[model samples]
Target: MGLGKTLQTISLLGYLHEFRGITGPHMVVAPKSTLGNWMKEIRRFCPVLRTVKLLGNQDERKHIREDLLVAGKFDVCVTSFEMAIKEKTALRRFSWRYVIIDEAHRIKNENSLLSKTMRLYHANYRLLITGTPLQMTRLLDILEDYLMFRAYQYCHIDGNTGGEERDAKIEAFNQPGSSKFIFLLSTRVGGLGINLATVDIVILYDSDWNPQVDLQAQHRAHRIGQKKEVQVFCFCTEYPIEEKVIERAYKKLPFDALVIQQGRLAEQKTVNKDVLLQMVRFGAEMVFSSKDNTLTD
Candidate 1:
């Protein structure tokens, strides 16, 4: 959640206005919880860009729509998803230079109302931002189906979960004799500001590319006051891209330790083309040569 998507988007807008001469009527749609953060980042990074928020009751919205929302007056308009939907008609009146959606997976399903409404507007360019990748979201869908078929009680937390709702979910899961059996969460969101000391078992259905993130998720169940010994299980396939990813994570752990214990600055590491090629080609030969049928359905 702290990967600087907000700052990156702000920089892009600033570039467009400063260099490209595209002083837009750009629109950014995000969750209600993040609108403040977005505004703060914009003001801190790009004060020259004019901004407006489309929020409030009908009268207030009417006043903004009638007065402050004139095109050319503002460079960026930030609003929540609810406001975007409610004020879609008025918003559609502008020929937007850019339409950016934060946590864009909300519209993954084209049939959903939000998706349909987003497409109704006109924008020269559209950008979608999300911490969860496409494959990760699809995997979650499969996990949901499996959990539902097993009739297990579970809760989910992602970028869109508000602070109150997130706390309620954690409290429910941690309660004594609670029926909630599993807590499904993306590593990025779950790795931050969560404590589940009552949990004794942590099953990592997937791993984050960053080893520290995976460690954080494991610590959620292994917190202080836990009576039973916490057990962590990490899921990984052999010789695929993930195997290489896990290897890279392990290599970085030593450097991370140095940074933590010795106050040494750790250089930021990135995977290059050779490593990427190896990751892509890692298991190909084995899969093509094997004759075994692994399917069981």
Candidate 2:
């Protein structure tokens, strides 16, 4: 976990400014807890550039927005997910040179309030930091990330319930001890930004393509502000595709699942290339050979 990502990022920002001649009024959207570290690193390493921490009470934040938007005073702005949404009216005014997100899982679900609002911020270059592989060489690596996010909205049904309905659900779910509230929600929409900390348990009625969405659903109750220990449950039927989803996730991250879920890692290996080809061929053959929806294994 301690991969020196912050140091490396500060290095890149400095390099781009000094040698590449890309003097940026960049934006960094990070967790409230880590916004200090982002600005601190920039100051400690790249002190020449003026960095502003976009936080404060409502009034202070309003003034900071004027500085960044109207005055265009700072070289970089470090803000949290909440402030990005709250300040989007001003944040949208200037096109950013870079929009970097720390712990990008915050916006893993595209239609979530914070996720959508972050996009309204125009950025010439976008960056996301996740626990996944980090290669500082690629700044445009965010294009794949952007595609994946947009694809999720199209794939998840309840994720499309944008605007007021989504806000109402978040508010209701965050209330302390809301009894008899059976919130039927999509895996993506139910996961991001909302303070589901008061929720005692979370039920994932189905899985999403990215295992991250599945993990996000379970963490809804596991976050800060929760009164009781949270329990997470996921259900999948006998479908082959459903079984494959879980198997692949556990296989890819056996150690993470072991600690996080308190489950043992099943002995797993890579699927054979020939076997994968056979599965693909079988699906194609079934589609052409029969009208039946079920493919016989």
Report every candidate's CA lDDT: 0.82, 0.67
TM-score of 2: 0.46
What does candidate 1 score on TM?
A: 0.49
How displaced is residue 87 in candidate 2, in Å? Answer: 0.6
Off by over 4 Å in 2: 68-72, 132-297
Query: What TM-score goes with each of the models?
Result: 0.49, 0.46
What clash count does candidate 1 reach?
Answer: 0
Error of 2 at 238 (Å): 43
lDDT of 2: 0.67
Best by lDDT: 1
